[model samples]
Target: MINKKLIAPFYERLSLVLIGILALGFIIVQGKEILDPLMFGFLFAILLLPVSGFFEQKLRMPRSASSFLAIILLVAFVGGVLYR
Candidate 1:
């Protein structure tokens, strides 16, 4: 007998485990295709680190201000890339 009260939590946990396994399977299947974008994002983040440091340390700006300016610059650069 599947008791609703007792089995509900068990089913929920099983569902979550299944979902995690499926996600892992998908990643394994598509793993090779994922590295390029991951590396690109990593390098881009490394490049941004200096600009953030410049704003925060050299310019004595707040983190929020630095972040906003960085985002704006990134958007502009992306727009330029797309336009060209």
Candidate 2:
């Protein structure tokens, strides 16, 4: 036979998880436009992190200068590819 106490907690936790998922889905749907560029910017920053670190550590450039140089390098790379 199944234990009733064990079943109740399981259902309760499942319901809470389902509700949380629904809430997150609703928020994402509502914020699609606002979230889109922010997410891209976040991803772009992550991609640039390594290049920036290289300039900062190996070349000993300042943080701001390294970040700007990394951005320019990436833009030039992308532009070259698209222009070809």
Candidate 3:
């Protein structure tokens, strides 16, 4: 026979997990404006890593120059999309 007592702890743990998830979702929603640009910059930097490495390694560009080029390209790309 199944015991109610045995399942009680599992239900308590599940409810706590659900509540934590809801709280995290609420915080993310409230902070979207601040989080959005930060997330975009993170993703954009990740996308540019390989290109920056190429410029630095293959083209013999300096670290600062390669990074600057990557940022310039990112801005240009966004501008192009907005312009179109």
Candidate 4:
């Protein structure tokens, strides 16, 4: 049979990992309202970075103008989906 002493430490480590994961999940749930929009905006900006670069480099738009255009495009796309 396997040594019980060796198995005990393995179970202890596994339980610690499980507890840490549960704690993180609880914190995320509690902060969801504030975190959700911040995360969404972060991801949205990442998604738009390339398009904004294209407008600035290829289309010769200014930095602010390119960023504004990217935002306008996103709004229009979302509006279209909602309208449809």
What TM-score fits each model? 0.50, 0.74, 0.78, 0.73
By TM-score, the best candidate is 3
Which regions of candidate 4 deviate over 4 angstroms?
A: 1-8
**Candidate 2 vs. true structure, TM-score:** 0.74
Model 2 accuracy (lDDT, Cα): 0.96
In model 4, the Cα lDDT at residue 24 comes to: 97
lDDT-wise, the better of 2 and 3 is 2
RMSD of each: 9.0, 5.0, 5.1, 5.7
User: lDDT tens string, model 4, 15-60?
Assistant: 9999999999999999999999999999999999999999999999
| Ranking of models by TM-score | 3, 2, 4, 1
- The runs of at least 3 residues in candidate 3 whose Cα sits more than 4 Å from the true structure, single-residue gaps closed, are 1-8
Deviating ranges (above 4 Å) for candidate 1 = 1-29
Per-residue accuracy of model 2 over 21-84 as CA lDDT, tens digit each: 9999999999999999999999999999999999999999999999999999999999999995
lDDT of 3 at 1: 88
